[model samples]
Target: MFERFTKDARSAVVDAQQVARAAHSDQIDSRHLLVALAESEGLARTALADGGLDVTDVVARARASIEAGDALDHGALAAVGIDLDEVTRRTEATFGEGALARAGRVLRVRRKHIPFTPDAKKSLELALREAIRLGSKEINGGHLLLGLTRAESPGRRVLADAGADLERVRRHAEGASEAV
Candidate 1:
């Protein structure tokens, strides 16, 4: 997995691990990862803040969800912190019944571990590239947030209504492509 990360991504993962520990969670979920990304000061950080989903707010929502035991399924994942429905839809569409199995697997994975899914990997790559274009040293939570926002999944309309800046995310991706 280290090989899969750019230096900055590895750093983000490290930060996520710390957040997981601080939260007293045995594993690092996407919410923690998003926080790590935001702390890393990447493109998604500014964009997400611009869209009104700041780290403090997201963390509060995640904590509330956890306390409410709302982190049950993918639906719960959204209710807690990662509000990008589009990405959830993509995960469902890409993995289908396998999505449930994979999500379970994700649950079983440790905070120090990175779950593997082709869609997740693709999204991560695209996000990291976007981070690089914004002069970020690593992939951050903002990048993951944008990836989810722009995902062509069932949650698209829901996320748009939530005010996710999909267009800005796309613009960043476009800039990343040009940089590449």
Candidate 2:
């Protein structure tokens, strides 16, 4: 699965792995991948911010949504008043039309269970491509930290609007690394 990654994507994966070690996790999930994508310098971050979003907030929301779902299952979506239409609107608002197109390409390469919505995956892949294009060998926590900046999710936009210093947090996460 890692082989499909471009050089920058591969580096992002490595950075995610290192971050996972630091976080004391066992595998690379989309949250880690989101952080990796943010740390990598690329369109992912640009598109996200351009559309008005934040990566950290996106992750936080994802966690919250999942926790809510864990307790409420399908009912959570109804109880929380979150709808696919709202999600779609948010995705378009945060990523722009180009991001959606790019995400489609990425979706073609991903597995069925990556957890990310099509929009998120597209943003991630584009971000990795941007990172590689910028000559970054590995995506770091800084890149992942930038996920909020690149994401096209609604919750993330709220965070960005709140003026979070996502880059600073990502830097801290990267700076505090442990050996894998």
The candidate that wins on TM-score is 1
* Tens digit of per-residue lDDT, candidate 1, span 1-180: 245455555676677667655554544555555566656665545555555555466545555443333234456666677654666577888778457546644664544554433443555665666556666655544545555454553223333444556676456534443443
User: CA lDDT of each candidate?
Assistant: 0.53, 0.47
Question: Where is the poorest 10-residue window by lDDT in model 1?
Answer: 153-162
Q: Clash number for model 1?
A: 6
Where model 1 places Cα greater than 4 Å from the true spot, the runs are 1-4, 70-145, 148-163, 169-180
Q: Itemize residue pairs with steric clashes in candidate 1.
A: 8-138, 28-111, 37-140, 37-141, 38-141, 85-155
The global Cα lDDT (0 to 1) of model 2 is 0.47
The alpha-carbon lDDT assigned to residue 5 of candidate 1 equals: 54
Candidate 2 — which residues are off by over 4 angstroms? 1-62, 69-115, 161-163, 166-180
Model 2: per-residue Cα lDDT over 61-128, one tens digit each: 53443333332245567578867456656888999855644664455345333244454455456445
